[model samples]
Target: MSKIIFVNLPVSDLNASMAFYEALGFENNPQFTDDTAACMVWSEAIFVMLLTHDKWKTFTNRPISPITTSEVMLCLSCESREIVDELNDTAEENGGTADINPKQDHGFMYNRNLADLDGHVWEMMWMDPAAMTN
Candidate 1:
């Protein structure tokens, strides 16, 4: 069986986080969702579990990071530069903070960063397939 990835993030507001992710095109899996947690499906192999702070502590004793701090940066690839920009815009429109870092365009690749309402950094990028061969 292929290995699947499930990234669990602690959210202050489960309903808001679920709405934010939905704006970015992720589908919610109701089968795995409830009041304290929401299962957002990025793909068949990738899922993000957004858990309320109370439920999150059940799995770990570590304190949740502050809103201004970042524990990790999650990056997702887009099919084109336009798509990257579109996602960034959607994120911003839906309460995510966009342009946290300077935009990058290296001829072969383009990327931008945004922070979710809970301050999780997410990088959106696009790369030219042709560049991989060279």
Candidate 2:
């Protein structure tokens, strides 16, 4: 069986968070969603679990990281540089902060950083397949 990754995030507002991800093309799996938690599928293999503060405590006793601080920055790949830009633009329109870090463009690869409403950062990138062969 192929391995699948589930990234669990603590959210301040479950409904808002779900909407934010939905704006970026993530689909919610109602079978795994409830008042306290939501399952957002980014792809067949990548799933993000958005949990409320109270629900988060059940899995870990660690204090919720402040919105001003970043514990980790998650990265996702786009099909093209244009797609990267579009996703970042959508994020900004949906309450996310876009370009939290300076954009990176290396001819072969391009990237932009966006932070969700709860301050979780996502690095959207695109790489040239032709460049990989050279």
Candidate 3:
């Protein structure tokens, strides 16, 4: 089987978290979703597992970080700069915070940061495919 990536994040509220991700355009995979966890599918190969605190604790002994601090930042690539802006705007409309970091535009690439309701950072980006060959 091909390898796939699943980003598991601890969220205070499962339903709210699911809504937040859905707003960013990810579809929920009911095959692996329930009250305690929601399998949000970004693509066939990329999924984000939103787990409630109790469900998350099952996979770790470490304490959950307070909302004031971030343990990691997740980045998603968009087909164009406009899509990045659209997603970021949707995130803000769905109770997320947009622009945690200043926008970065290197001509060939652009990105903006947003914080989910639980304070996890999601960076939306766009890159020119031709730029990678230069």
* Span of 10 residues, lowest total lDDT, candidate 1: 125-134
Better of 2 and 3 by TM-score: 2
Q: Write the per-residue lDDT of candidate 3 for residues 28-97, one digit (tens) a residue.
A: 9999999899999998899999999999999999998998898798888899999999988998899999
Q: Could you tell me the TM-score of candidate 1?
A: 0.95
How high is each candidate's TM-score?
A: 0.95, 0.96, 0.95
lDDT of 2 by residue, 16-73 (tens): 9999999999999999999999999999999999999999999998999999999899
Instruction: Give candidate 3's whole-model lDDT.
Output: 0.92
Candidate models: Cα lDDT each: 0.93, 0.96, 0.92
- Which model is ahead, 2 or 3, in terms of lDDT? 2
**What does candidate 3 score on TM?**
0.95
**In model 1, where do residues sit more than 4 Å from their true spots?**
132-134
Q: After superposition, how far is residue 132 of candidate 2 from its true place, in Å?
A: 4.1
lDDT head-to-head 1 vs 3, winner = 1
Rank ordering of all candidates by TM-score, starting from the highest: 2, 1, 3
